[model samples]
Target: MTSPATPTGSTVPTGAESADAIVVGAGHNGLVAANLLADAGWEVLVLEATESPGGAVRSAQVTAPGYLSDLYSSFYPLGYASPVLAGLDLDRYGLHWTNSPDVLAHLLPDGRAAVINRDLDTTAASLEKFAPGDGDRWRHAYADWREVSGPMLETITRPFPPVRGGVELLRRLRVGGALRLARRLVVPVRKLGDELFEGEGGPALLAGCALHTDLSPEEAGSGVYGWLLAMLGQEVGWPVPVGGAQKITDALVARLTERGGRILYGARVDRVLTARGRAMGVRTAGGGLWRARRAVLADVPAPALFLDLVGPDALPPRLVEDLAHFKWDGSTLKVDWALSAPVPWTNREVATAGTVHLGADLNGLTSYAGALARGEVPRDPFLLVGQMSVADPSHSPPGTESLWSYTHLPFRPNWRAEDLTGHVERMEEVLEAAAPGFRSLIVGRHVAGPADLENGDPSLVGGALGGGTAAAYQQLFLRPVPGLGRPDTPVDRLYLASASAHPGGGVHGAPGANAARAALARDRALTGGLYAGVIGAAHRAVYR
Candidate 1:
């Protein structure tokens, strides 16, 4: 690695390019943390291993020139609705939203489709097409969402255990109401659909959303993920940043630079420097040492932070043992295309949708999910199709469409390179069934398997999108190997600020925002002591 000369700026302090904080990765979450810290008058230095930041949020013309495809994450309902992102005022920095007429459509085998729109009544009417009385159930669930979604989103997006949100939700729902809500939250998406609606349409819609996470429809705690995304789709239409996903990173980088923060691209931090059991600085692959006066936040996977950077020798024995059992979501295969024309969906309604979900039905989704869990690829795969041009005309050249689709594969697939080709072919076959002559519309195509995805973004370990599995046992307080369930790591002055942190994965910048608050609190002696005492007590109560 080549160690280049350190640059200069007022934000760059005297010794070793020092700053108030040193962020190890320049993913969206890392940028979010840096921006927040700099806004508070702290000198921040963000280091990225890649030549550019944005991690998986960046977009490119992989298929052909002028065909912009989001490299990884595409839809961002969470980004639109996230309170943390909202506070950042990204729009002022040149981020624009492009929304489709409908948020999402799930096409079924019977030629019927379930569609969700921003308008509640319209979405309800769509559900009515599936079953007569299911529309009423849809409205009832949304009515409940109106009462609790704010607190629920606040709770998940904030710190763990969500004490305040829990209390506020309890107050709104009452004791009996809260118990009922808990039941709904704990069950599998399949069970939730059965309990709430009698129609296949409503349940299928929910089950399709659950696939967005690694969780299968039958898994506990998946119902919440399904409920939240579907609710948010209805509340805030899924949107993409105008121009491309890169615009989001461009806006964030601009905001950070304006606030006097510096980002060092091509600086790969190899290890976290520690003195007296506290993080002091980072030693880069390029042999550069950057010190931090206050904190070091890592926007990387938990295993990378602990296993690679911190090392097992420095961590508590229990935590290290837990690391061995840490699970990963299934690997994924994604395909992007520069289409000669828009996808001609067999279902006319699906043609107008921003996102189209195709699984024969609930059974098809469940079967594919089960196949992944069993270390096998499914004969028939579930497809999540995004019509980028339909959502935003600027995504492609005039009259052309930029389209993409992805399907999950077994995390540890015992396969060959040829197997990946078969998977891609299978994915196309599945799509073709839904949209006849889809392959004929493609002018150019690109595919990324698990290896390609991980090579592109280290945080997407084993191609797990959420940074880790979203199973009930590993979520909430147990996330990223338990302990306090907050940003603070076992090592003082080092914080975990990535999708591996609380609130799991999404475009939402909660992990970064939450870590920033923790770091700021620690920087202030008053809040630091109080937070430490509480977190220490929480660790003793839970882990000890």
Candidate 2:
């Protein structure tokens, strides 16, 4: 195991034959895993297929030179809240976060908006304008969330090895916290929010937050996401980097390198070169064999890694079947707007907002979901709009604004070029209905369909951003399939360190942290506990 010369950006060809560990993708998660391993003396070498390190973590001047757009994951409430990320010391590596006063503003049909101010009193005061007591409901959920969320986050984000984390979480969280967490996690977001608030905008707020991952409010497991995000927003508030999302990645890359980790950007790993039941290394797509003596980690999704990259002979038969049944999260189509000015809102108040939601109502969100299920792009799609210029001034030239808005469509759409164009049109219509003349604000716009997402990185996998679906059926240990807790697939030491694994998605490093913990724990003989066996059996079954 050796730490070789620092390999530069995404174009460095790999001629090296061996390293301490060879990670297959330089996604933020892959880089995070490599850094953690390197910090523990693993001599990590990350090989990315792309010409750059940031996978979905990239920001580009895709539309114009002076304006930058975050390609994916613009608002990072979840990323900011993850405990695993807290320990990484990202701020020390040059990444900084700025919190806006009003975190979210959801526009309605009547030109009225539900604005969530960072201060609870301010948010409640605003809610009071919509209806009475809705303010109190906001207060209750926020206060309740403050009590039990810490342990709940730990259980959800910690490693799945033999399921030890769950047991430990229950042990650490008091009886009341455990009960509250259980009751909160099981209900539907629609039901939960409706039960709590008595205002015109309460359900709309819940629906908007829940749909961040494009999950309908009525969907199973919607409660967890909706509550976590909304409550977290009330707690820490949502923050973004000063320039764009790229600052987060740049900080991560700097810290990883500063900690003695080696990164190679352009060398794409074609396969994990394995022998027998043990892990060996990765061979770059261009015929360079970069072998890892300790472990071969893949930041790739489960399907691509197991079915496409590793041959069928490498996996168990049951896992082969599960791979076919694995559900992928819906694909994302993005539109970047380089605006001459802010989006012109009919209400005028939303123009200066940090983040705005565009849709009709809760019905509009439901309509969007129903249409997607029928393979039709929603006639009234709910779009998450980020006015980056409002959040951070450096995104554009003075008086100009950089805006990004995105929405989810079904994984397989009967899309011609018009289907995508039509979707964008519908998005504009919804925005226009909420904020009159939104279309007129567009100075330049760049559209990315599934093809464009694939062009950016094959890892988006048909533009499914979270690697796979975030629905209840695919979550937890069932994620990417049931069996293996480690990112390692049934194919020996090959691990799935992407967002598709347990503790799924977002810009958080939990999946990568989980994988690295598993790799190192194996070496340290630390995962031999009994709870681990159950977690292992579950992992093996899903992957089998």
Candidate 3:
């Protein structure tokens, strides 16, 4: 098996290489696509611009030695629930998952909290503490979710239009039922919470989950994301890799290599070489060319893929114009700490939770979101905090905590060092309010601002974590631009296999799996021509 490339300053071979398919960017999505294509017996070559794989799904001793912290994403409820990831059977490749005692907890100014435990009754009881009968409401909501979750998840993760999954969903929840569900999904999270629960506990839980995306509680369709994630956590506890986030990437790389796939690191693709309107291969910044016999799957952001790599001149005029209006999610600021001891939360239950949402109640959350929308740095920022050592003991030394928290910021062209430091202090203030003397426990700390995040991974453009905005206007069939919501781009033999495509972001590999499936379907000898003809015509109509 081939070893992974060095983490920095790796040499680029100066020669033209050829493979059955060239997958650009070695992010989890790109890796997932490569692994699937390799399983189909096609020789795959992955070109990563960075020194290593995993993009944001990486880990390092950022705060202090022996304190391993996930550089970007930490929790993975989606990863656990994702059929695509589960189908890969990563367990055989040394990937193990572990969860904290509780899935998540949302802390309030009053020191009260709403917690979700692996046990449904425990979660319901926690909500019931807020108000009488709220527990039953939560149970009912979960039951409803359970009835639709199977088909709902399938319809979500499958290729857009989700024909088979849609049919099953329709059969289960008739025409009127489907219409009602759709209406509910489009409602604002605040409204959905009010409709579903009487107490602050349930609503607070939903609102906290919704903030996980860029969407605020009042935004339309935000409730769907809130409900989806919350229910997924209930079904499958928010688990983390036993060691670090890197294990997930290592597992994908191991599986790909086992199937005879190759990955070239530090290979920054400068251009996607197209011949007669069809993608042929790519040329790296080092003046090396790699040709693909069949297809090229790009796991980069939409703007980078279309404007920078492919060039606007090569794309349809309409597509280029549409891209100019692409909306990025809010930028982010993250802080990591190697603590002398665990955060002494006012609510002891929060310490048992892997993820904690602090610095906001419903009204506080609304104000914080509003501040971000108006391009103002929030004084009371909502913090999504992770206690890494609690989730996976291997992340830090005994009795110590590897902790992190990130909050969204408005997009800015640049951030001075002082500006980042100031924001980091603000974030710490939020944490300190929830856990008094939180600052005293820090042994070391590292801060990553918006620019730092983008520099580390181009896909996280402007530090927008979900690839692009998950707003209603830019989702489903309209994601990355209006089209069939499939992976097929205007260019033939090229697919958008990143979170920029339909279904947006998360640790789930749906976008990559969808792209791989599209490539395979169009390469089949029997119906390949027909599939290409239909998809190509659709692209023409959309771009015309």
lDDT of each: 0.86, 0.76, 0.89
Pairs with steric clashes in candidate 3: none
Please provide, for model 2 over 365-410, each residue's C-alpha lDDT reduced to its tens digit, 9 standing for 90 to 100: 7788878777676666778888888888788878888988888888
Predicted candidate 1 versus true structure: per-residue lDDT over 355-384, tens digit per residue:
989866998888889888898888888989
- Lowest summed lDDT across 10 adjacent residues in model 3 is found at 1-10
Which candidate gets the maximum lDDT versus the true structure?
3
**What's the ranking of the predictions by TM-score, best on top?**
3, 1, 2
Candidate 3's C-alpha runs over 4 A off are 1-15
Top candidate by TM-score: 3
lDDT by residue (tens digit), candidate 3, 142-239: 98888888888888889888898789878998999899889878999999999999989899999999998888889999999899989988988899
Model 2 stretches with alpha carbons more than 4 Å out: 1-16, 161-177, 484-488, 525-544
Q: Ten-residue segment with the worst summed lDDT in candidate 1?
A: 1-10
For candidate 1, give the lDDT of residue 533.
Answer: 68
